[model samples]
Target chain A: MLIDDNDIDLKINGKIVAFTKTFEDIVVCRSGEEALNYLKQHLTTPERLPEFILLDIQMPEMSGFEFLDHYKKLPVSFTEGCNIAMLSSTLDFSDIQRAEANPYVVKLLKKPLIPAVLQEVVKEHLQR
Target chain B: MDTPSVKVLYIDDEEHNLQAFKASFRRQYEIYTATSAAAGLLILQNIDINVIIADQKMPETTGVQFFKSIKDTYPDPVRILLTGYTDIEALADAINHGDVYRYITKPWSDLELHNSIKNAYDAYKAKIDLRNKVSELEKTNDELNRFIYSISHELRAPLVSVIGIVNLVKMEGLYNSSGEYWNLIEICSNKLDFYIQKTLQYYKNNKNVAEHSPVEFEILVSELISLYSYSDRDTQFNVKINQPVGFYNDAFRIEVILGNLINNAIKYQKSTEPNKFVNIDIDVDVQRAEITISDNGIGILNDHLEKIFNQFFKSKNHHGSGLGLFIVKEALTRINGKIEVTSDLAIGTTFKITIPNGKAT
Candidate 1:
């Protein structure tokens, strides 16, 4: 799943991941609110949840950090199976430090997503 | 032209002396006379006095003591001490610690008194002006720092996205078949990123204070060389260092100086030259490091060499934002370093830099 406000970023990152052939299907939400809603809808059915989610740091409403705050409240079954990583164009040190410190975030990757990095994250997740 | 009257305050214990003093300078200045230190405090609160003249032999407080007491509250007013006795110790103490502008003896000459008051007023105005200028500079620096932070983020976001899209296109093998537009996009994106990086370097050079750290030139030069190695240009880097002793200076500033000069060397390489190269030579001692970076590229003209260090001074056929060399010059100044450049058209350019050790002995 890709969560970002920029349409071009979502499309390109989605295409890049698709080319890697790692996931069967990709889900994209334009805002953190919409992404949270999707998670809530799929809370009962863990199988419907995405295996890996690439979240963008900057958004118009409810930024990526805020999304993580709301995400932690959901049942462990939903968050445990899914690996979340923050992808951002932000060059700020504080943003990088906070993302690294967040328990829910697996990695903080700079934009735009490279296919090899996405594959490696998935591989690392399966190994764990 | 008529000049505005300088507001003056004369404080004395005796009534006749205050009257005599005001009678002498009432036409030249707007004189406010107080017969006691307590009354003088009252007048200061009510009016904006430019100069204050106090009698040193008052009953409650000497002139130096009075000046010291009001130094904190009424610091802007220029203070002058008036005394009948020539007590050198008290006068020296007043001038050194009490912020006394000047001390005038009793039976004051009108001409001498007038000159002292005029000079005191001028000093007061200069102090205020200096403070205003300093505050204005701080405001500008703050605005510049904020502007750089926002502009770099705002401009680089979309620019990065475009590069990502380009990367995606290349991975799909679509760019190679229809490579013209893709190559153009790639070139334009790289150029934009380059300029943004240069601007950030300029800001960092101005904002950060130089730090003294032990620098290994071999590692520093190798890292910089690897950075430029990613470029498709065929220019080679030849480095030779003779640093037997420890060298300490601001490593970040040294990087700026070396990075800009090397970047310029690679950037201005003659496209047709098959064997182009940049030579970096460093001779280091405990006191200083002398470095020379030379390149066999499309060399700068004599006329352009002098103006190249000026901010935003772009020569003909210049590919950069013209900030590279200017940042190098500024970084040198901060580190107490010096640079000398010599270039010939179609021959080559060399920059010689001498950076002193910043570590305190």
Candidate 2:
């Protein structure tokens, strides 16, 4: 499932609408705080958990980094096998280093996210 | 011509010549008439005299001796010797040893006196003007150096942040299910690329006067739009190009200009809206080439429009470092280009850029 803060453009949204044929569900959140809250509230049943989250680093309340900080202390069952990829428009080296250092972070992807990047990620991590 | 105000000191023991000298030029000049050498030395201590004319024949001292005494202490004031035929040899000695400006015979003409003083004043003015110019140039050089240093620091800091994030992704063996983390990394990288390009363009434009070349409009616009179109399934943006026939253009500079404008449109668009649209129009003639890029997004406020082109100036909108427009303006200036903008908040903004076809006359 794909998750992003921005309202996906009509063209990309259309693509997502088309791609959903292959996926069972998708989740979206505006901030890392909201994402973490949603995961915690839903983890009790564990059936509604998403396999992937398309995370954005810059947000209003809690950033992606803060979300990861809080996510680390939560029970492992909450995360399970879910992957979190950080997406940003910042080319800052320190941000890149911070994302790389975080264990929960899967990869640091630059915008705008094209199909090639998505395919590469799926091939490297989810191909089984 | 009006006689210049010369500060003359007569040191002759004979009171008659001292009175005669005062009577000769008192009305025409601001004469600082001193009777003795010691009194002349005292006057020099309080006032700024431009020329010091002294009598060669004195009771206790010669004009050469008095001139020698003040040479090092009051170096700027031009020194001259006034002497009778009998004191001609001593006058020569003063002129050679003390570097006196001129030697005048007794009963010197008022016109001759005025001419000498005027020449000395001109010399003094020239020296002061030269010194001021040098000091001003030094200040400008220091400021330019400081500007280059700060630009380097700002660029490097962001680059370091991007590299650090990239390293973490590679070394930590961490895996994420969400694509958000990767998006952040991409944003950082793109920003770095923009800054590096800007720095290079600035350096190149400043270093050479003749290196700018005509730009290709249609090709550059196509390339920029394709680069920003990141999502395969995202809203598609249509870029349009219309140039007047028979117009030749400078392709390189136009690329840099359009690159910045289009980048901002993509970067600062309203986030809540799903139907994001960016439009570009280009028209060129022999005299100038005009381009307009408009986007359906959140627009800039009135207060920020004035400072939008200033270095490192960013609007309250949280998308860019504010260097994009600044760099665009700089690049445009090198080619004698002009840019103007009109926008409505929350609706859209349009940028109109005109590039002169040939070098500015």
Highest lDDT: give the candidate number. 1
Weakest lDDT window of 10 consecutive positions for candidate 2 chain B: B168-177
How big is the positional error of residue B233 in model 1, measured in Å on the Cα after superposition? 5.4
Give a tens-digit lDDT track for model 2, residues B1-361.
3644555445665678767767877775667767678888888888887777888878787778888888888877777788776565686688678778888877778788767766766675676678789999988876775576457545654454555445444433442535578657756675676666566555544544544354567777788778666532243466667774444445555666787788778877777778888888887777887888998878888888888999888766475666778878887887778999998987898999987776433
- The true-versus-predicted C-alpha distance at residue B321 of model 2, in Å, is 2.1
DockQ of each: 0.70, 0.02
Poorest stretch of ten by lDDT in candidate 1 chain A:
A119-128
Once fitted onto the true fold, the runs of candidate 1 whose alpha carbons sit more than 4 angstroms away are A33-45, A48-53, A60-85, A90-108, A116-128, B1-51, B59-61, B68-74, B85-98, B102-126, B176-179, B212-219, B239-249, B281-290, B343-347, B357-361
Model 1 score (lDDT): 0.88
Model 2 scores a TM of 0.45
Model 1, residue pairs in steric clash: none
Per-prediction TM-score, please? Answer: 0.76, 0.45
User: How high is the lDDT of residue B252 in model 2?
Assistant: 56
